[model samples]
Target: MKSAPRSAVLHRMVMPGHTCPYGLKARHLLRSRGYEVEDHHLATREETDRFKAEHGVATTPQTFIDGVRIGGYDDLRRFFGLRVADPSATTYRPVIALFAMTALMAMAAGYAADGTVLSIRAGEWFVAFSMCALALLKLQNVEKFATMFLNYDLLAARWVPYARIYPFAEGLAGVLMVAGALHWVSVPVALFIGTIGAASVFKAVYLDRRELKCACVGGDSNVPLGFVSLTENLMMIAMAIWMLLAYGM
Candidate 1:
């Protein structure tokens, strides 16, 4: 006879005004993974708290397989040979999302400006928008960004203030480019930072072979230091050169 399918017991919070989305996700995961789930919904806050206290577990949406606790969603993923939960784990997802959104926004702006998406204007908008997005990420926590930047940036390591001011400079350049004004300010700023950033990334990642997290997305980002970081600097350099050639600055 064939063996019965494995069954799981899932205890999840479904209290009034507090439906745990993870609980639904866990249930979906269980069903998708070929597990018969016995979902135990805690319908009230008091009941949820009592369950947690009784079980000595910190959070809800807990799962059990074969009478052995498999933990929450992250734990369930691990139990099934999926990704493990580590808060500081490095990932490129955030940077990818930011860049993707920037591109889309630039495309939209291009269409709005002249009803054309395949023009040189679109490319300029893309680079300008990308700079703004990156600057915003760094500005979220300047202190944290500065700390991470110091790990690789030559000027930041020597002069701490440069790290603090980097985001503002990048943002200003981006805004000026977007407006098609103030080439005197934006051109120099973009060229200066771009040159320094490219050199720093190259020396640290290519020459020294140092493995480190990029501070481009944010100070607490998991984005690795390499191609993406180098690309951002290169884009700025290219944009600066393009602008100079166009306006003779």
Candidate 2:
């Protein structure tokens, strides 16, 4: 004996002629879940409610599968015959995580450099020539030598030693300090050096505030350092100690 096959009904109230956005969303959702059923779109809201009532369906997108009812969109998804999108597949990696970190460290070092200078802000500009201390200690590290001449205003961005401009200047200052000529030229030297230093730091801070990049040392080494504090003072002190020995000779 062959029994009558059970029929499943799908009731929708979507307007006709206008593509059902919900139906489209549902299509994608169902397809993702391996559901290959065709959707039913209603021409009007009234017709959809009427169909629901007649079929004892409770909501929109109401599914009667093999004569069993499922509620709404969410319910349909749970009975999904499709796979879900992988959350991990959409995640991303940080682009500038390491770069920003390294640049930040440079900024910190720059700040410390400025601070140490001002702590021993000597009125006598001649103290700068004391940088001759480098030769005495035989410290040939480019960065350490450059630190002696770090004038933020001059070196923060626009200028770099293409052929040892700073090294030459440091040597000149060292010679003058050694011969005691720096004492006579102390005012002008101090004014020049301090002005350059103050400007350099300010420029770095300004660029940092404006998010501008620094181009120092013929490279793109932009970083920020605020006002000079105890850091630069210590640098000056170290230079001064060396100058005392340099001058003694």
TM values, all candidates: 0.83, 0.27
- Kindly list the per-residue Cα lDDT of model 1 for residues 104-198, writing each as its tens digit: 88889888989977678888888999999999989999999999999999899889899999999999999999999999999999999999999
Q: Tens digits of per-residue lDDT for model 2 on 1-249?
A: 966543444545578555545555665665565455556778887887787788776667776576677656666666664454443342112113322443444344445657432233232233343344322222345554344334443543355552135444444554564444664343234334435654555555666453322222212122223422212333344454544555562
lDDT of each: 0.92, 0.45
How well does candidate 1 match the true structure in TM-score terms?
A: 0.83
TM for candidate 2 is: 0.27
Candidate 2 at residue 139, lDDT? 34
Candidate 2 global CA lDDT score: 0.45
Clashes of each: 0, 20
Worst 10-residue lDDT window, candidate 1 = 83-92
Number of the predicted model whose lDDT against the real structure is largest: 1
